[model samples]
Target: MIRHLVLFKLNDGVVRDDPRVVEGARIFASLGEKIPELRFWECGWNVSDRPIAYDFAINSAVEDAEALRAYVEHPEHQAGVALWREFATWVIADYEF
Candidate 1:
């Protein structure tokens, strides 16, 4: 199996109560379901309790490294990533065993 982990840090000014950011999160969450390779998904706002922690984490499981690669090249996820980069500090990585 493969684990696709993404962390996002949103700029404070445009982070909370912002429709675009909110929808962006929601849309990404929805995309996970639409994509067959995605075995799981989780997302949420950053809590004040954790210092220097990311605002959100999209934790997903896929069949293999190849499936994760396909997800990265998929049109829908690609579009969302492009749009999301404009407003947040995005970081991602994946691993398998």
Candidate 2:
């Protein structure tokens, strides 16, 4: 199995309640049901107030490299990414388990 993790930081001056941010969050939240390659999916806003904490996160898993590739290329996933591009910046890590 592969674990895919992502941490997102909202852009300066942008709040989570902004209409665009809200829509972006909704899009990503729905990806688990929309993408078949996603074996596991959990995403949400960060609850901590620490300076090092990112604004959002995505914790997911897939079968393997091929499955990961498919998840990355999936159209619904791409659309969510596009929406996020406008409001946040993120980092990702993937590893075999």
> Which candidate has the top score in lDDT?
2
For candidate 2, write residues 61-80 as lDDT tens digits.
99999999999999999998
Candidate 1 has a TM-score of 0.85
lDDT of 1 by residue, 1-97 (tens): 8888888988767765578787788778788677777777677666765777888778888888778878888888887787777788878888885
User: Model-by-model lDDT, in order?
Assistant: 0.78, 0.95
Clashes of 1: 0
On the 0 to 100 scale, the lDDT of residue 5 in model 2 is 99
Best by TM-score: 2
Cα lDDT, model 1, residue 85: 79
Task: Count clashing pairs, candidate 2.
Answer: 0
